[model samples]
Target: MDYDIAIVGGGPIGLAFARSLAGFGLKLAIIERQPLAALARPDYDGREIALSQRSVRILDDLGVRHLLPPGGVASLAAAHVLNGGAKRALVLDPARRRRELGKMVSNQDLRRALFEGVAGQDGLDWLVERDVEGIAFEPASAALSLNDGRTLRTPLVVAADGRLSQTRQAFGLGAEMNALGRSMLVVKVAHEHDHGQIATEWFDHGQTLALLPLQPRQSSFVLTLGDREIRELCALPPAALAAELERRSKRRWGSITLLSEPFRYPLVTTFAHRFVAPRAALIGDAAVGMHPVTAHGFNLGIQGQATLARQLAESARRGSDLGDLRPLRRYEQRHRLLCRPVFEATNHIVSLYTDERPHARALRGALLGLGARTRLPRTMIGTMLA
Candidate 1:
């Protein structure tokens, strides 16, 4: 076999998985369509990732946390969730002696750090600037045919490709995908007032907005709207855009100025029916693409990849084949147990918050009130961050 395991996609989750497998004495390869330079120096795409404590510990173990750019990771001191135009908000704060709920980092920086951490790992090869044209699955091994006419045979193949993973489809795995007819516009803005390291999410009538604190006066302003509305908003000039944000936010953060280019993404969430098939396994977005509303996408991806790596390591220690179904099934069951609840709950939240019906508006407002008064909702969110 050309390698013991081959990973498709070199995104953060994929790279982190490879890095975690270092020193395991298993030959590995990371196949990415992007060139080496792109992975080495990723461009900011206006997306910030909320890192749970477990994710931070995993990155620390993989040696990618230290590679992050200075001042890039931000502390999420607190979070406030508001409903409609109501003044009452549900506040979530860290427990005693805990300085932060979690950390925030840009997706670009995390990817770059993972790429750097995986460099110089022994028995690992990078198959970059190439696409996997086909895969032939056999009982003993899986053979991947690249666009460059190179065939790689490995005992196991892990797919970390995006939600619409062609490899997952090729493996005959099915996924339940929800393509919400909404797009989220993300932009970094410099506000006149201090954010106090607090993040705010507002599920106002007809729209959803989140202000993620970064540094002191900077924050990531995320606005979700219909597809057409978002496109029109993106076409506005910088000054007009900032003004519109101020108006939408009711000048809560005082004045806002655009600090970076706006990035828009159509909302989509997916969950695979199975995370394993024959000698194949799916990780990252391939296994589950989460709605960014709960900010669990990459966090869950990191957890899933780490779980798979542990299973593989244990199997290897037992001198079992890397592609053994017994271990792959264990990874599948464990990851699914962790992913399904989050995926379902996030989708339900998006549904309730975006419905805009009179009943939904009333119910959500009541829920926010309940959350503010009760510890259940606050505790749930705190646990998610931890």
Candidate 2:
């Protein structure tokens, strides 16, 4: 098989890339190791992605925004950060930043929406349950060998396969993986409080807990803790775990109960040393995997996909080689510039709040107080949503 671009990984990032290039007169194929039905399932477990205004705008442009299930996307009008056990809260109104601060949607729903959008468009092909065994790149085209003894060729190959990208390894791309000695326990809970479209985060000395408002009478709870602590919590029965969460959160929502099984993910920062190699380019987590503390991982992926599509489209308009090193370099440059600062900031914030030193605690409290008083910092955060 031949195509203008071969995208490895049928996740939201790959699907978004396909949708972005729908009308560009380019043939694109997405290869995935999982069946389409598996991705479309409503019960798939993953963190809910908080889409920024910029991300929503890009999705709207691709005409997939409405495909999100009814009530699947929750508008967050306000965000509150609490310190010292919710004794002090700093509230920031995201609505003041833009028409809508952002929207929270299940990862499965978002992926299904993108897949449907791409599947309905022309010049897009889906290859599921197919794994790439190896990649051989040349100036004219790149050849990808599948485990099933089939070979696919394309002028450009996008390595959106994820942080552990096999394509990246085939091309000898090096990356730095910083493993934070922490994991996140995420679960949905039924609550009596209205929550009023408010997203709340509570930062204690060693852990940070977040309650993200979902549709009527529900919210997603994300608890970050050390590995040992997580294991202990996981060993507890469901009711016990709910009790612990309620105590940790200081019963802010009156009382809490688990609505689903708890899911845990190790916290890590994956930094791909390069974003492009010869006839291939990287997008999404394949390029940069961020800490979840800032909720920038998926949003960054969307932005990277959009930036790559726009750069390639411009190259095509000028009759330039789409896989040319120059065009790919431009994409890498812009994406790195946009992602690096957020990655660093998130890491720094995590370290500051999770430290155990008394001095660090005092510093964290002072910083939070200062952030509350400063209009400039608040404005900058507001602009980030925009």
- Candidate No. with top TM-score: 1
Query: What's model 1's TM-score?
Result: 0.98
- After superposition, candidate 1 runs with Cα above 4 Å error: none
- What is the Cα-based lDDT of residue 95 in candidate 2? 40
lDDT (10s digit) by residue, model 1, range 200-302: 9999887889999999999999999999999999999999999999999999999999999899999888899899999999999999999998889999999
Number of the top-ranking candidate, with lDDT as the measure:
1
Where is model 2 more than 4 Å wrong at Cα? 95-99
lDDT of 1: 0.91
The 10 consecutive residues of candidate 1 with the worst lDDT sum are 377-386
